[model samples]
Target: MVDRGPAPRRGRPPVSDEQRRRQRLAISRHAVRLFSEQGLAATSGEQIARASGVSERTLWRHFPHKESCVEPLLTKTIDAFRTVLHAWPPDVDLAEHLRSAYQPVLNSPSATDVEAVLAVIRLTHDEPALRAAYLVLRERAEDTLAEVLSARTGVPSDALPVRVEAAAMNAALKVATDDLIHETAESGITPDALLRHREHLADAISFVTRRAPGDGRD
Candidate 1:
């Protein structure tokens, strides 16, 4: 009788969700670099898979379409910010909390991931498909913001005030993010410059939410 070593364990070892997410993110970083350099129309899924050191099957498993490849990296930034918002302490003001939490958020996404995100953002200007994906992600982020803000402010997530505030805050954040990405792409942002931009973003959110002192804080 010949044994085949228990059928070679049937399949690959089970990967943790975090590991799977990281794999997808790695693939996305490579895809974004190709898209930025070669243009979306010129870049192929096979090229992205090769550049990412993954099989075409693996790449397709992670993303439904080539344009969707950038979503994972772009999501890292929004996820970092959402994490900060979710951890907000009720006693502390949003601005103070953001200022204290911004550094970790800024540092959470790998430098390569950050650059990939910026590249995708820049590509959105010329690639309608990428722009559609970008906008969809932005909408999802806004929904997350609405939920977090509603919890923080004791308002219903569906309330008009909560939705409006969340939308306005999201718009302000998007603008700030675009400006920073543009500047960083051109000249690269120093640590000091990045911190300043963080402060500006926090201040913009504070203004949009009327969270500044004398705006209603006790």
Candidate 2:
């Protein structure tokens, strides 16, 4: 055969950005399960690879370390929240904006994926490495929140209030999420309960946006 050029890589043909994200998420799911079942310190890279049905090399290709496996669980909510904010109507109140378009995790989230989220949360309170990974995910999310807040408030993202609002909102979200996960772990609660709690979350978010005694919309 004439030079067929370098052989194409294996796996799905030319994975799209979405596909790559799904693959990373799949790896994370397996890692979370392994971590939860065997404790973070006891879970091995080999085990993560085996759980994901990928080789050790493939596991490393998807995640730098096993602990980062919880990245998706902690960060996925931010993406959902950002999407809602970006689409929020100019004339709608914040509470209504969230309720009408909140996209409850139970109503919209995949059942398979929610299980992974639960496992990751169980690991978060116990695993130092996973906790660090969760923090990194939030740091990136805070940047996303800053942009969303800027767009909603018509303020420069670098403005003091905008940054502070982003930080405050991100922190509140983290706390709310942490509490929900903890509650879920204890009582086997549903994600609907999490959405129900968003009212208070919305109030906390609005408090920051309304702190200057002005509109909370663009």
Candidate 3:
């Protein structure tokens, strides 16, 4: 099985969200460059730690293994989705809102952040372990989307249609992100691509809202 990171974080919050996010992003940056340079299996946590200016213990403190480093990279896209979803307006069409907004946000990502995201996407195909980490993250993303959709629609958590709609939205996002990663790693995931064809993703999310039993909650 792929070396997914440690067990799901079940305990009370460890550190402040900002502090942990900083450390995770720091480790993600170092690991990506190192993996791109030496190749995946050849890179070690110790080397990543040194490159990140942290200790071996600190490396594990953030990521359980070398492959797990990509978790944050994959999550960068999901995080974007999360941010947008949280801010989604009740009146606006989901697809149109995302299509109009995604590019600006993506363009705003720093060069290093973009590089790390591309590096992980390139390496994912060659590493089963990293792929597992990516999938695990995506599954968590489904729950996140579900919760947000449920809250917005006021659907009960166990409602089957809500779950199905959440699944469809999550699935659409996964495909869009995978396609973006593969293409971006080659030529680049362009603004036009996100701005123009991006409605496919929004449509996917919107479809789920329709799948719900009634008019969307919000």
Candidate 4:
């Protein structure tokens, strides 16, 4: 997990939505480290709070349960992918757009953030609660994905093809992320090294969608 220097001082002014989000993300980073070092069943909310330099009340205020603490980081990953999809040009192919915009590193997210994400994802394979949280976030992403696909294809978001493609895209992303993380564990994972993973993700998405160039009506 990233070295979050310090939690906000107590008795500070009320936080804005963005401040609250940052706090949650900071707590989440610490929680992921604890979860990685200790299994979900062994970890406690109090431990997470202590690790985050926040109170149990504060941790619970941000996350309902220990497993749910991972939501913010997973949500960040989903949001990054959504940003790429939303920016997809009508004239460009999906793979082509992703190749340019979908860098996992060498961009906004730090190396520590990526490692934390990888740890959380790996844990989900054995931890049912964490898996639930992860899948739920991915499930929620379907709507945003459907909307973007609809805009590109001129199909209603509710249409069967659009919905199926959106869901498939999510699955493809999940699979690609898992594969890349696993592969990078043995080899060193660096900002530049992650670009290959990005390419792999693009390839997975392209294979699953089989979308044609100029498919976007818009």
Top TM-score model: 1
TM-scores of the candidates are: 0.87, 0.82, 0.80, 0.86
Summing lDDT over every window of 10 consecutive residues in candidate 1, give the lowest-scoring window. 103-112
Cα lDDT tens digits for candidate 2, 1-218: 69889987888677688877877777877777777777988989998888888889977887787777777655666777788778877667765677667642322355555556756766666777777777787788889988887877778888888788778877767666666666666655565765655765676666655652124433
Error of 1 at 185 (Å): 3.1
Q: What is the C-alpha lDDT of each candidate?
A: 0.80, 0.71, 0.72, 0.82
> Any idea what lDDT model 3 has?
0.72
What is the model-wide C-alpha lDDT for candidate 1? 0.80
Residue pairs with clashing backbones, model 4: none
RMSD of each: 3.5, 3.7, 9.9, 8.3
Model 4: per-residue Cα lDDT over 116-167, one tens digit each = 8888988988998899888888889888888887876677989988888888
Q: What is the lDDT of residue 71 in candidate 4?
A: 88
RMSD of 4: 8.3
Residue-pair clashes per prediction, in order, are: 0, 0, 0, 0
Cα lDDT tens digits, model 1, 89-177, are 76777777788886423345445556667778889999999999999999998899888877776778888877887798788778778
> How big is the positional error of residue 157 in model 1, measured in Å on the Cα after superposition?
1.3
Candidate 2 regions off by >4 Å? 1-13, 104-108, 211-218
Is candidate 2 or 3 superior in lDDT?
Answer: 3
lDDT of 1 at 211: 54
lDDT of 3 by residue, 1-218 (tens): 89998888787676888888778877887888888898988998889999988889978988777888777666777777877877777766677678766531233454456556767766777887877887788788888877877777788746887677767877888666666665566666566555534776777667655544333443
